[model samples]
Target: MTELRDAALASKAWPFEEARRVLKRYAKAAPEKGYVLFETGYGPSGLPHIGTFGEVARTTMVRRAFELISDIPTKLICFSDDMDGLRKVPGNVPNQEQMKEDLNLPLTKVRDPFGTHDSFGAHNNARLNAFLDSYGFEYEFASATEYYKSGKFDEALLKALHEFDKIMEIMLPTLGKERQETYSPFLPVSPKTGHVLQVPTLERNLEKGTIVYEEPDGERVEVPVTGGNVKLQWKPDWGMRWAALGVDYEMFGKDLIPSAELSSKICRVLGTQPPELFNYELFLDEEGQKISKSKGNGLSMEEWLTYAAPESLSYFMYQKPKTAKRLYFDVIPKAVDEYHQQLRAYPGQDLKAQLNNPVFHIHGGDVPASDMVVPFSMLLNLASASSAEDKATMWGFIGKYAPDATPETHPGMDAAARYAVRYFNDFVKPEKVYRAPDVQELAALEDLVAALKSPEAALEQIAKKNAVMGNDEPLPEADYGDEDFLQSIVFAVGKNHGFEPLRDWFKAIYEVCLGASQGPRFGGFIALYGVDETIALIEKALAGELG
Candidate 1:
């Protein structure tokens, strides 16, 4: 327990006291094992929003923290409520007309126009799985359709129904409804009909321990439940699930605070332990509106991977308080840059201290010292200047110098690069190597190049030039040129300004080339490819020849 407290305190990103309290409760209530952790979200009714990842990413941190403190083997379950009915069409999803027709049914019942899967639910599930997998999350995905079909949730459902009145009583105030008569507490999706099940009159029969429902035609029926229709309504579902799963901790958005409050009441009624609750702020788009699939304003996890590294994305999710404030995509690059700087600052310190910092909010308020390290992109650019086929060679360099760099550090990098290479053939552009440079950047870059007499001198000149430019301006872009010319510029820059110990130099190059201030390493990138080819690739970029 003491060690656990120390770990929690050490991780500044975490709400140490809150986490500690939850762990203490788990220890008291069930000393045999810690609680199960469930992270749930709706499927990609459209593109999966960044907020969805926020929930899961934060949960991963809490789970990791628990694992650090105790011997509890935490299970992080990412349950997709794909069986839920679609209330509206999202911007990213196609075939709007067809979706509208199936919106009333469970997601699994909706036909998939893309044909990648059997249903819309399956398609979205696949996408979500791909996104989570890219993040290196070890999550057990439980689809609502599968859970219902497999009967894994049957017991919990029955229990909720048995406590119907209590559940309704707990939920009404939260919903600000006079009574729970308008709609049934259950979602009421008919598994047989593949449509919504509408019961006009739903009443709890406490004595009979059943839920009595009346059809439109005036036919009445009673569905028997175990424990007197003790099922929980939506508001109390959180507590019910926590008890059933023995969850130690869970996080929700502020929008769900009312539900969480009601859930606490249910926990008391059920006489079962409830998981600790951590509420976080929602993610907003540039518009300041909540980033939601319904609004079609959110950034998808896939889109993020297309441009940024996985560690950057993870770091974005890692640094904030779950309950603090809204997040934006525009802030991500800075977070990534800071993560690199932090790693470099205390490189020789205790691995834990080096890895742990609350600044890059992964969990609520704690960031553990990460054992994983990867070459920054700037460093990679420096290396690419030396090696043309830089991918493999860069990886080898990483294996030697940064062995701790895991797949999570650079998610989808290989696959994306492979895709780009396959698409463009042997003519992949330099912008692909780094991000496209803007107009002002081109002038600045030309000036820096003119100042250099050799490759090493170019590096020093570039660094000095950048220092003069300050942080307010964008980075300079490379001018259009021949392969040999591009090679000379890259070589000159690498000689002086390049990061040191090779890895650092590579990181520095990525920073300079992309104008990102920090990115993947250069040495490994050059080792992955030959120097001449890489130079040619940069020339192609300057000329705007490759896509």
Candidate 2:
């Protein structure tokens, strides 16, 4: 347990903690392979999506953790089920009519609907590769269509052929009567028309390694199970891939629990235990509806990167992978801000706390060591309040806050300012609802602002100070006012005024001063933006000029 407890402190992550538990079980069960294997599946029925990004990103983090814990090597096999038959024409593609015409054809056999590659599968695979490569993901992508055609899956295909009856018994009872009557463990692609046929198997010969099925036109076809002639049904295919690749871990969506159950059973029946499974909850939209490519509901890759860094998106997925969370654009700022906060504070925390932090893992255990003078959210608030339409206009606020600031000197601020400009224009401008502080709130805020005006507050302390604090303690002798000092001051001031919820104090401060209900942490903002400017901003709001 010491190793396990301290493992979390050694710059490793939870999923790595997860991987370690699974690997211990795997090592006891089977030690044929020295290195652990992690597998993630990509279905190319549509373009690469945020969900796809999440799967790969999460898997990679686990893989990274594995590398840290063990001297043994590891690999992430990104398997693409490109051989699956096209059921319907996807609407996002340009050549929908052509796709409809080629329904039921294997994805790799159908011509590229978007005219980008040799086949639709290849096109989608290329897109997936391009997207993954943009993130510098370390992976080896496996194509089912090519693997089947090249006979790489032939051994597993043969095993399924031999266990055809058993596989059917495991699968058929779970399906509807109609499907049960027609279902087979194998779906053979016609060697002639190249359509993946779903007809019932008329006869199977293990010795000959072939199954006979009749085409819709009443043509009887006998094809060998090996060499791209057949494909195991989805459930059995998943099981076979696990056994065949020696996959020790597989992470999947929560919706596939039933399928995962069946697949694990199939794996057991095939004489191998199921791979270690990690089923993550589905990502939902702002309305809590499931994000689906077919339904077109959720943030897109382009939209996320448009207003936030890729690190922010990575950090979003790193938090509670098993718990359900919204992936809408509105969640973007907080994710970005959180990522920045964790990175900034990583140096201050112990290795244990650092390892537990999301940004610690999102950054591959290497956090950027500098804190931004102003958080991205503060910059957004500042930009929106100033009605600044661009990054250049937002620079003065950041400069005033951090005297030595410039695009080059404070790259984080520069990038954030630029993002704040666009994000303000898109989401913040029309949503502004400033409310004046009431008399009670006003009096407390005035005292706080005056304290901020003293040049001995959160931002100043954050910039140069450090000391442990308790209730109503004098300001830390250090120059910068870190989170502790900020928290202490806010708590003391709010307590003095008998402010219930305490949040209302910050809310009033934010609404009156920043013209938004939420902004950056009040303490950090005050320090970074400096007392005089904050005093002026709050005084103007009190003057009703801001409202």
Candidate 3:
């Protein structure tokens, strides 16, 4: 463990790098809160999205990395700002007519359109927890509604009231003149209407710990800032949360960098250093537009899970966090394949390399052995070829390729097979555009078909031809079961028939036989789907039956 800690200390993986930053916060002394606090905040204004999951997943990775290098206990808080008023109804949810009436009310007081929980905020919070729990993240859920009403934030609220002018000095310059005139850090909840009123404060009394604001109807009302009567504006609230909870670390999207910086300054005015911050680049949709929660433009957490394992999403979150990635259904298969690829590489890696490996942080150093004998991309190809509707059909091909594996022993492979079929039916089937191979591609396909028909004799002749050309590396053993030998045969066919950039050969095969422009390695597909089956598939393409 000490050796692993040494490796972790020097490891350059982003999680370790971020964890090291958190560790430095206590270089002089441990936090007075007893344990280092890591927090991920949720607005709960809309349903929990994939980006929401990414925040917690990435923070957990840093927490896991911290655990490896230090003995200080750590606690992760999944904080929800549910007390904020709902400015508008989310178009995605049901009962829209009912929600329009609840605008400007605290989310906890708004009706749950789903009708499953006490309020919309509670419903969204449940969804967020379900999403986090589905991935087995260890976190304590903190609701703004509960915190404020329970007096948990009372001390912070009083402190903000005492430092009100300082916070206003920090925030006022950033807002336009009109907004600056009316903006108050405190948004008081109107006693009569039960709405969170953002009206201008008429009076400030620090001695009473209350503020006076006039209602729209011209009624003057005085309310204590503490005990859920008032909530701070977003920037001040962010800093207040960090100070109140003694958070050691938190991360947000790059879009929030200015807000985070402003809040960090506010935190200092509140008499606490800001948490260590990691501002990751925001996700983009397929069209390169920034993903918007209200616009519903990108993949959702449930949508990603519908087609791939949670860990694949985590794997996607783990890689190049500072770089913006397109989060869409099209990226799922690649993420799944690459995640398993990393998993397959883990057991052979040394401790230093393991510390840097994504799966180590992803699974919190308890990485599982990958049971995926068949790659996800290949399973999708098989799904396309066989029109597979279930894992059972894919399992037939899986059983033939690796006779020892089964659903009972290789559950992850079983899940991938299921996901592949669903993914193909949903995304691949609709986009398939089969085209007849062009002249060069046709000739290459014919050569490939001929070589596959008599693989053994063709490989032997190709070996002699290579030998005569002074390239005397022996051909891979020409066993029908040998995928590499089959690949070599396909490569020779493509090269001999002069398919420039040889990928054209594979592309031709996919377009003509599989109705897609690119696919898994043809040889591996053939080995798994059967050479005889591939021969018939090509014959159909040639006969115009496939197109």
Q: What total of clashing residue pairs does each candidate reach?
A: 88, 12, 0
lDDT for every model? Answer: 0.55, 0.79, 0.90
**For candidate 3, lDDT tens digit of each residue in 228-261?**
9999999999999999999999999998999999
Off by over 4 Å in 3: 464-469, 474-477
Give residue 466's lDDT in candidate 2 (0 to 100): 25
Every model: Cα RMSD to truth: 9.6, 5.1, 1.6
TM-score of 1: 0.63
Better of 1 and 2 by lDDT: 2
lDDT pick, better of 1 and 3? 3
**Global local distance difference test of model 2:** 0.79
Better of 1 and 3 by TM-score: 3
lDDT (tens digit, per residue) of candidate 1 on 355-385: 3653433432344444434433333343434
Model 2, range 385-467, lDDT digits (tens) per residue? 57788888788766765678788887877787788889988888777877878999888777666555554543343332222
- TM-scores of the models, in the order given: 0.63, 0.86, 0.97
